[model samples]
Target: MTRYLYKELHLAASPISWWFLAGALMTLLPGYPILVGSFFICFGVFQSFQHARESNDVLYSVLLPVKKRDYVTAKYLYTVFMQMIGWVLCAVLTVLRMTALSGLMPYVGNALMNPSPLYLGFVLLIFTAFNVLFLGGFFRTAYKFGLPFLRFGIAALLLISIAEVLHHLPGLGFLNTTTGERLGLQFAILGGCALIYALCTLLSLRASQKRFEMLDL
Candidate 1:
């Protein structure tokens, strides 16, 4: 947590980003694509980028006594911070769904993706898409983000759709199970996706820093 990043998050982050963090509460909804909650989280981060671009925050930040990579690192750190917050919200709701509310008809009858470790893994997958596709793409031009965010949105929606139908596939129904019947497999999926998220985010950060360094700004 560099002091620069601390300032960027606390002072420069858009109010819209904070508002959209509430999207994680969508996890409480049944009969809906709960994974869309993760999409909203990414969208909120995107809003932060959009706000930065509109306000020329990048140019302003570079003029400060900060290295180019420091600015990039700050953005990445803030993005990850928001994502971890969303993940925590989803995780807490998942526990409720698996325990106190496990037998609720609405949640139990959800034809959409149910709250589970597998669901959390899909959330991480969506965040990975945002990092690699959106953040990485934006840094390529620093000034262009519309196309990158469009790509991220499409990828996120596609992932949500895939996650929703996965439980319907033969032998994969346990992915939506509320019981501990396949606890080992569920945790394995979550662990694997968490690893991929960490690795890919770090790679994207490095790639973004390099790209930003080469920019004439």
Candidate 2:
């Protein structure tokens, strides 16, 4: 299982794929924050699946002793791995934003720009929805409907993120509030994200297993 996951990660991280991963950096700019990074990571999954199907990577890979479940598991792990990379990038950008753009806090909340436990929950929820559409659709149609579903997820995430920034900006005067209140909020958010992460992880893996079994792959 670990080996297969490593293989998937390496392939996804290689050549044009890495270029695609690097492309996620473009979205880390002001206002956009993690939207593009999230899109890029998830988009990388589509690219990999596309290559696997087109190049017979899946067909060839399955010829090994590995079970279909391992393949499906590897794909999920691959996604989780790529998302870790995205989160790291998000963390770095958060640091840069806090230091370089602290004066701009009145306009955008720190939550919008940084890595927090609360942020992880939303990110996980987003990916959960993305995978629900992608893996569910791909397994049903062999990638035929997957891209459209993923694009929809990406576009929706972008729009929602933008809306979040606009809608919440007025309440961010808390940026200047007492440290205790801010810390309390952060802890509450962290707890929420932790719950979301656990639920989504379990559900995605199980769903992928079921979906993979339905496929001829």
Worst 10-residue lDDT window for candidate 1 reads 1-10
What is candidate 1's TM-score against the reference?
0.96
TM values, all candidates = 0.96, 0.74
TM-score of 2: 0.74
Question: What is the lDDT, from 0 to 100, of the residue 162 in candidate 1?
Answer: 89
Cα-based lDDT for every prediction: 0.90, 0.59
Regions more than 4 Å wrong, model 2: 10-14, 23-28, 31-34, 100-121, 147-155, 158-180
The prediction achieving the highest TM-score against the true structure is 1
Task: State how far residue 70 of model 1 sits from its true place (Å).
Answer: 1.2
Kindly list the per-residue Cα lDDT of model 2 for residues 1-217, writing each as its tens digit.
6888767765533345555666446434544455555666667666777766666666656677987766667776776776667656655654454456545754364345443334444555555555666765665555585575656577557744753564256876443232345756756755675576557666767876776777775
What are the C-alpha RMSDs, in order, of all predicted structures? 1.1, 4.1
* 24-63 per-residue lDDT for model 1 (tens digits): 8888999989999999999999988888888888887888
Error of 2 at 130 (Å): 2.1
Give residue 206's error in model 2 in angstroms: 1.2
